[model samples]
Target: MKIGLYFGTFNPIHVGHLTLANHIAEHSNLDQVWFVVTPQSPFKKKSSLLDNHQRLEMVYRATKDYDKLRPSDIEFGLNQPNYTIDTLTYLHEKFPNHEFALIMGEDNLKSFHKWKNYEIILENHYIYVYPRLTKVKTASQFKDHPKIFNISAPIMGLSSTFIRQEIKAGKNIRPMLPEHVWEYLDEMNFYK
Candidate 1:
């Protein structure tokens, strides 16, 4: 079985996230797209991050109905300052039978080399990159790259940070997140 690993903080799982995962699963060769919830992203700010488990739960709630989309808390047990290469190694060891692929936007592709053991990640796993408004120059930067895919899913250009900001401002996030997830966010008063 082939699985596309879509890693993110998912501060609050939204429609854009669901759409991308659905798009990848439907359009790609992979059988499923796992949402690998990151406890902390090295490149991102830690001050504004909510509890990792809560974020993971929202992801679970958002993707519960979709069998093709799964919420994976694999990074929760791993070391802090989680790196993609480390997670990939651990998953490969644990699930040897399943073929794992890396899923990300073109934005991440441009900054791929900064990651630890980046060379190993490129060599070991297939990378499926989705296009964003900012077309990153990944092809020129990384030679002999892994399986790069450009999916035609709808792009909302929305970020978890933006969603959180909207909540903090007492603005409605109904348009930002899925119906169920937004309901939970309202009930919990997250990002307040």
Candidate 2:
């Protein structure tokens, strides 16, 4: 099985997240795009992040209906300050037969070298990068890189930060989130 691991904190899963995963599954050779919910990200601050369980539960509710896309808590059991290389290594070790591909954004592509054991990650697995419009224009930086394949996913620019802010401000966040997730957030009063 060819699985594309879409790693994210998913402070709360949004439509943009699901849309990109679905697009990747349809456009690429990947059979499944697993939304790997990381407990901690090396590059991101944890202060603003929602609890892992809350985030994971939201992700599960958001993706329950999709067959090609699913939520994963693989990094929860692993040590903190979780790095991409380590998670990828663990996934490969556990599922020897399945080919694991790393799903990332253009933003991450620019800072790939800063990751731990980046060389190993590049050499061992395929990196599927989706466009994330930013002033830096890092997408072109690795346009034809051997290990990285640029795939065309939606460019909504929807971010979890914006979603959280809207929720806290009592703005309608239904547009950004899936119906179930919006309902879940409404019921739990998440980020309010």
Candidate 3:
């Protein structure tokens, strides 16, 4: 099976995430899109993230209804400050028969060259890039790369940061998250 790895911290899984992942899965050749929940992103501050298990649970709830979308805790067991290349390598070895590809935003592609062993990643696997609202331009090298595919998916303006801030401010963010995820957050009183 061809799996697109959508990596994120997912402090709280939201509808925007689900919509984008589902769009990619339905439109692309990939059979499944796994929401790889990162325990700690190298570029993000760990202190701002929710507990790994809690965030994973929210992802599970958000993706449970979608056949093509699934939640993954693969990165939780990996070393701290883990790089995408390392995760890709481990996943390849673990699931030898399944092909893995990357699911990223156009904004992320702008900084792709800085990622560890990015050249190796491009050589070994295909990348599915979705449109994102960003002022930065993508690197010229990636524009015509054979391994990179530009998917005309919807540009999601919603972000987890905005959701968290709203929740903390006592605003109803019910529309931003899945029904189950909203209930989980309310019951736990998270980000308040």
Candidate 4:
């Protein structure tokens, strides 16, 4: 089976996320896309992050209905400051039968070289990159990288940061998330 690993904090999974996951699953040869909820990204700030379990639950609620979209808490039990290379290695060892690929935005590609053991990641795995503002599609930029491939997803200006800001400002997020997830967020009072 071909599995696409879409790793993110997913503070609150929104339609944009679902759209992208659906796009990848529908257009690509991948069998499923797992949203690997990272406990703490090495390059991002943790101060604003919600608890790992809570984030995982939100992801679960957001993706439960989609057979092709699964929520994964594999990184929750791992050490702090989770790195992509380590997680990929762990998943590869644990699920040897499944072919794993990385799904990320073009924004990440610019700084991917700075990641720990980035060379190994680029050499061994296939990357399905989505387009993003500020990171124009450039074949020359990744000519040296053998596994990188650009994918175009529906354009969405929405983001978790925007959702958080909306919640904090006393604005409703009902439109930003799926109905169940919106209800769950309200019940749990997340980001408030």
Error of 1 at 114 (Å): 2.1
Cα lDDT for residue 89, model 1?
Answer: 83
**Maximum-TM-score candidate:** 3
Question: 28-98, model 4: which lDDT tens digit per residue?
Answer: 99999999987865667666688888888888888888989999998877776768888988898899999
Tens digit of per-residue lDDT, candidate 2, span 1-192? 999999888888899999999999999999999998878655576676878888899889988888888889999999877778888878889998999999988888888877899878888899998887683466453667797888878886899999989888889889889999989888988888
Q: Can you give the lDDT of residue 192 in candidate 4?
A: 86
In the range 1-192, model 1's lDDT, one tens digit per residue, is 999999888887888889989998999899999999988756677777778888888998999999899999999999777778888889989999999999988888888888899877877788887878776676574645445656677776888888888889988779878777888888887889
Clashes in model 1: which pairs? Answer: none
Better of 1 and 3 by lDDT: 3
Cα lDDT, all candidates: 0.84, 0.86, 0.93, 0.86
Clashing pairs in 4: none
**Segments in model 1 whose C-alpha atoms lie over 4 Å from true places:** 41-46, 139-146
Worst 10 residues of 1 by lDDT: 141-150
User: Candidate 3, clashing residue pairs?
Assistant: none
TM-score of 1: 0.91
At residue 22, candidate 3 shows an lDDT of: 99
Best by lDDT: 3
Lowest-sum lDDT 10-residue window in model 4: 135-144
Question: Which ten residues in a row are the worst by lDDT in model 3?
Answer: 40-49
Q: Which segments of candidate 3 are over 4 A away from where they belong?
A: 41-46
